[model samples]
Target: MRAYRYLDFITALFVVVLIVSNIASTKVVLLGPFTFDGGTILFPLAYIFGDVLTEVYGYKRSRRVIWTGFFLLILATLTFGIVNALPTPPDQQSTAQAFSAILGLVPRIVLASLVAYWVGEFVNSYVLAKLKIATQGRWLWTRTLGSTLIAQGLDTGLFLLIAFYGVWDNALLWTVFVSNYVFKVGVEALFTPLTYAVVGFLKRAEREDYYDRDTNFNPFAVR
Candidate 1:
């Protein structure tokens, strides 16, 4: 294994985004006519970082980061659950209730989020990797936008159905699904220029522009 100057930093940022997004997702926010979870504002950046990771470092290293994010999310969720379940001091019951209201983990939502993230991120990385080979690394925008479309669709659909299918009204469920998917893909498209910048800088800085021509696409394989 070789060390890259920014791999650890990028991975840390990616995991931090993942954990914070999950925490923020507890609130549904209304932005004018559109409604979305607070996480929607920043969660798309994870995919952008994913695109950069695969575009610069290749799928193998990106796989390691994705798995790192997955386990860290589990740890965060478990820690929150445990802390929320602990008894509060005499004068802190109100604070405890408020904390639980914001941080408590609903098992179904947590499961849905974890599964969706695992599947969506791996698919995103794999698609971009293969596209890099197919286009011979010609068009960066095509790969980024194309992969994000498919990945975000899977992620939003799976999460909404699993977490809120019968819990919310059918109409509201569809609204959230459409709103989240559109917003996420739109964010990726909007950030294409920035993605190009970061990818270019990382490639030049690390002297790496990896293509996954002979790489395995297994999601569970850590190596």
Candidate 2:
């Protein structure tokens, strides 16, 4: 495998975003008319990063990164669960309770996150890759936005239904689904220029603009 200066950095950031977003998702916040988990603010970036990775490095490399983020997120979720399960020192019982209150929902959240992320990201990468080939690498905006359109829909609906269906009332669930889906896709569309800059820069800097021609699209392929 060829080494690139920024791949590691991008992977690290992607994993961080995945883990932090899962943790932050414990809180349901109302920002004006928008009702969503705190994590929604950060989660859209994962898709954008997915777009950049596929656009520059191809789906195979993006698959590895997606899996990397997925596993690390599970590790973090397990760690939180374990830590919460441990006995709290008497002096720190209050803090422990607070921690439990905030993170107690992590298991379900992580499950939803893992499932949605695994499926959604692969689809995002796959769609973008195919779009790249279809357009002969023209109209980067279409690829990014088009992929986000489908993938974010799957992600938002799955995550909300899996994570909050019974826990939240139907109205709240529907509101969040609408809000999160719109926000995520809107964020991707809003970041088109930035995506363009990063994609162009990475392609130029790394001398790579990978197309998925003859590339395996299997999500489980090791290579």
Candidate 3:
């Protein structure tokens, strides 16, 4: 395996985004007319990061990174669960209650997050990789934005449905799903230029513009 200049950095950021987003998702926030989880604000960046990884390093490398984020997210969930279950000191009982109020929802949120992210990210990478080859890597924008449009829909709808379907009423659930999906895709569209710049820089600096021409598309494959 060849070493890259920024793969580790990008992987670190991607995992951080996944873990933070899962934790933040415990709260549903309203911004103007849009309603979404607090995680929605940062969660879209994970997709952006995914695009960059697949575009610059290829889907195989991106697959490893995705699994890294997935396992770390599970570890975070376990950590929160263990801490939440521990007995609190008398002086910190109230604080523990507050912690429970917030992070207590993390187990379920993490479950929803794990499922959604696993499926959504793999689809995103596969689409972008195929698009890169089909376009012969000509239109970078198409691959990034196109893949995101599909992946974010899967991610947002699955997560919202699994996490809040029964907890929130149907109306609010639909509203949040639409809001999150639109906002996430809009963010991808809005950041097209920045993505171009980053992808360009990485390709030059790393001397890598990977195309998954003969690579396995299996999500569980360990090649």
> What TM-score fits each model?
0.98, 0.97, 0.97
| Best candidate, lDDT | 1
Per-residue alpha-carbon lDDT of model 2 for 102-152, expressed as tens digits? 876556777788899998999999999999999999999999999999999
- For model 3, residues 1-223, the per-residue Cα lDDT tens digits are 6899899999999999988887788788998888898999999999999999999999999999999998898788888889999999899999999999888765556678899999899999999999999999999999998999899889888887887788889998888889999899988989999999999999999999998999999989997
| Model 1 spans > 4 angstroms off | none
Better of 1 and 3 by TM-score: 1
Clashes of each: 0, 0, 0
Identify the candidate with maximal TM-score: 1
The deviation in Å at residue 109 for candidate 1 is 0.9
Q: Assess candidate 2 and give its lDDT.
A: 0.91
lDDT of 1 by residue, 1-223 (tens): 7899999999999999999999999999987667888999999999999999999999999999999999999999999999999999989999998999999879999999999999999999999999999999999999999999999999989988899898999999989988898899989999999999999999999999998988988887756
